[model samples]
Target: MIGTAKYLFGLSVGLIALLCFAAGAVIDRRPDVPRAPPPDAQEVRAALGFGQMALILMGTSSPVSFTLPQAWLDGVHSLVSHGKDNLAMDGRIDGRGAVFRVSKRLTRHGWLNLAFRLEETSAGGAPRLILYAGGWRAPEWLTAALLRMGLPLLGGSQELESLIPAFRAEDQTVQMTARVPRALVGGLQAVLGSGEGGGVDLELVRAIYGELLAGAVLEPEPDYARIVRRAAMQVDSAEGLKAALVALTMFTDGPRVLRLAGDRTKTPPCALTAFATRLHGRADTPKHWVLSAALTMFMDEKTGRAIGLWKELDDSLPGGSGFSFVDLAADMAGVRIGKAARDGTDIDKVIAGLRSGRPEIILPSAVLQLPEALPHHQWKRRYGPLEERRMMRQERLIGNLLDRSPLYSRLPPSRP
Candidate 1:
């Protein structure tokens, strides 16, 4: 009996070890880079199709891969972030990293089809792009912040609920109203409940949007889609921005192409800074792994996708970084932060170690001007003081370009 029991125990131990070896081998396999839909896969016959797709190169991760158009964009950028803010595409945020694909046979008579994908796979490798453009406004807090910082904003106040009375007509539920921009007078007249007091702000903001930003005042009230089409005609039409955000935006339903390249001489108005999005929440606080892991974003939803890469840290883990931020970037860089394989024992050390390399820090393209732009609320939301110092120091590298670009000439730019 003793001999038989020993044999069974030895057999069970061997089986367990074999299972573990198989699991380790599976994890060790490299991730497969996604390829475009096959040539015969109906996109070619259909009117809607992507012009190009290709695996670009590896970024901050060892196992993680980057992809873009086979051709390089004249304007390309790379940078890092500690995970804050929404990606500002035309006006649509590619929220939750869900796919923002578009198809527009634009028939205005019926109802607007709002397609929201709950599945994250749909928005793979794409930042959120605008679907319909021309309606989004800088929120009042942001406006006040920017205005206080010295932007040429027309006007706004902190009691934003009062400032934008568009939905207060009958004390209804969260009503979704779509304003047609071209028909300015008609749009204003259509204002439901807040009376004349609200009309002026709407008209003023719309007019400025169309004129100073959009560069063309609409003759008649046009639907949001139409407004986007009209604005797309200009080199810098404020309305043109919408097409940049959503994957399938329409200029009267045309497929606008975005090329990605590394050359720094030129830039796309819509291109974004590539920042590292860490999802362990604030490492400074303990007992935060679950709350941080389940984070839901309120504004600028694209941060959701950046976090999607790290959603596997189940709520029950005895949480903490097994590796420092820097070390994790090196060790897990290429590994998919899948459900079974996230949450480290030393995340704090990993972060510190990676940064400790002391990479020559740079600024996000949006607020590269530093302390001078620092005072502006628009600038502050995107960049803080520590980054501001980095930006200030780095400007010397692009001093000549800053001197020549019309964009910078408008700002103080000089060191404070």
Candidate 2:
């Protein structure tokens, strides 16, 4: 009876060891694949269906596998909170790999589709987050053309930022009976809300938006229009920027692409800067993680100086609040922040690590936000103050650009 019991116990222990070995083998056998490059806009549009736009690619590495579904869901929720879309997933797992489907509205009549997948692939031998979107292709050329035509709107470039402010009509203290397309609301808001009885009155703001639109005197620039249309058709190739002029064009011309890029301004718009700063002082309202991460990255990039891209990012939140350049470029691009928790990682360190060793920091080419453009040459090669001459050029350039706005003369000077 004792001998029989011993044999049974040894058999049970062997079975357990076998199960462990199998599980370990399953976990370790991810493919040795490399990360994919940024998909060509035309190709991505084709694959995801052309009706959708905006691609977010995140990349990271970890010895332990993540709960990918949870991470993806968290990402989607974050985006939706920032008004990307109310997204749902339809997915399935096959041996060692999985795929997810995501969709959203791009316009009243148009919808966008996307596909998300997880794989053991790396870019330059590092893991990457792969996202694909479908919609009307608004390429860099189109943005540049629009800018030259005085649209003051550019999207889909990490080097440029959006200048268009978002409109929140429902938040108005005083309600107006008429309803305008949500697309047109932002321009109208910008026009109406320039400066009123006091600071940030929504009703007064709406009124200001209307007055500015009505007061503008505009003329046709055939050359600018021709360039824009051509660029829209051949977005992948257009590089040099033609001079886009400032004219109050009707927002009703076509679908208003809310994702816009700002001109090369060295500082954030003063109003935005002040608004973000005020949030820091409010005890009732906790600062957002995106804002916190951006501020942290901005400070690190500025070398502890309270200036540069971080300040601009803080101020620009009103135009498209709730999204962070760091989130889009790094975390969403797949650098697992949580994985580095034991490495004493924080937002500042993560940003510093990513920006280091690269000739230029590359940001995700999403709508509304992009990394502040770096100088073409060796950025670190400067004497005294790094990039001082370039900084002067950017400041002058932005000043001239802002001066051209119809609302510029009426708006109170942004805090210097």
Candidate 3:
């Protein structure tokens, strides 16, 4: 009886080791996806335009269907994955369903890959999403089991339903139809329905850049207000102004704008010093956060995300610079600028004020009074979450200051 028990124990140990070895083999580290080349001027221009147009379309109430071509998706992917190779995605639509494969590098020696298919099904007389998941690093049964246990907790299905109300899968295409604001539907159709064929008009972009540079001599260190004024003066139509705004916000980093113009080597170091300086200044707010806040003006629903991302990033930093209300003030300034541009009214009046070259016209003086930086622990102790009363009061103070300013006051009322 003792010998039999020992034999059973040894067999169990061997089986466990074998299982671990098999699992390791399945999850072994492999070479990451090759780094994609950085998007060139044209690709960047197209992607930025598409994003802006998409946001505008999403605001409308008209239902429209559009197909995204593979090339366009690739450009967007390249732009989003510019400096990283740890994550990659490939998606396709077939008669059966829409399928996507996502790969994420989890560690130095392991990668997790997921393949999922979404099919539209009629259940209880309502269209529902049916998800089918497969695995690359694990067995199919294990992957399905994990997804069954995980997706409910993650609320993945509900989110998808909310984002995509209706979609039809065909060969090499998934056509999505959603209700957008009616007024913008025609314009959206003209721009988005063109697919990859609609490349950005570089000539117009160059003209906008030329206008910006023309005023540089008078105000060598033009602030945000000056730059907007120059662009607004050059673009007479709403569409043209939108294009100009998209170009301005495309790169939060000023040097990238110089590179976009052409070879950075040929451009003098001080050529766009003021423009670049303004972007990186203001209490060390991350450039990406500034970009997010600027972009959120078009999609008002995402304003909270921009604010949250900024606070989250500030919290992650070590040392004295935790969450800075000064940085928040700068972000609010950008958001105000974006909202003014989006309103497409009082362009003449706005230009007149900006032409005065008063920085205070756009950024009120009260922003200077906000605390520069507060460590995370201290910020929590005082303000708690961002929506807490103290924080809201501080934001209200900034709003009142902006309301009292000339530039922001001219525009219609908008969300902070």
In terms of lDDT, which candidate is stronger, 1 or 3? 3
User: Which runs of model 1 end up more than 4 angstroms from their true locations?
Assistant: 1-81, 85-237, 244-392, 396-400, 411-416
Query: Whose TM-score is greatest here?
Result: 3
lDDT, residue 262, model 2: 15
TM-score of every model versus the real structure:
0.16, 0.20, 0.45
Candidate 3: residue pairs that collide: 60-180, 60-181, 61-180, 61-181, 61-182, 62-180
Q: By lDDT, who's the top model here?
A: 3
- lDDT by candidate, in order shown: 0.23, 0.26, 0.49
Candidate 3, position 80, lDDT? 43
What is the C-alpha lDDT profile of model 3 across 1-416, one tens digit per residue? 99999868855765564355334432446523334454443444445554665765555445455664445555555554442345554555566456655455656767555455666554311123433222334444444444443344443432344335676656665566654533334443432222121233445655676566555655664255556556666665444544455445432245333222222244433335324525233424334323533354344313423443244334524533556665666566556554555555676665565555455665666776776566666766776444457766777776677677777675643242
- Candidate 3 Cα deviation (angstroms), residue 251: 7.9
| Ten residues in sequence with the least summed lDDT for candidate 1 | 71-80
TM-score of 1: 0.16
**What's the C-alpha lDDT at position 281 in model 2?**
26
Which residue segments of model 2 deviate by more than 4 Å? 1-72, 78-100, 107-110, 121-266, 269-416
Model 1 Cα shift for residue 120 (angstroms): 24
* lDDT of each residue in 1-416, candidate 1, tens digit only: 99999867855655554344323322212211112221111212111111121121111111222222211110010100112221111101222322221111122322112222211223232221212212222233433443232222213222222221222111111111121222222222232111111111222222323332232232542223223233323223112222221111111121111221011123333333321122222222111111211121111112222232122111111242321222212111212111111222233332222222121111113222323312223232443222256433443434433334332233223221
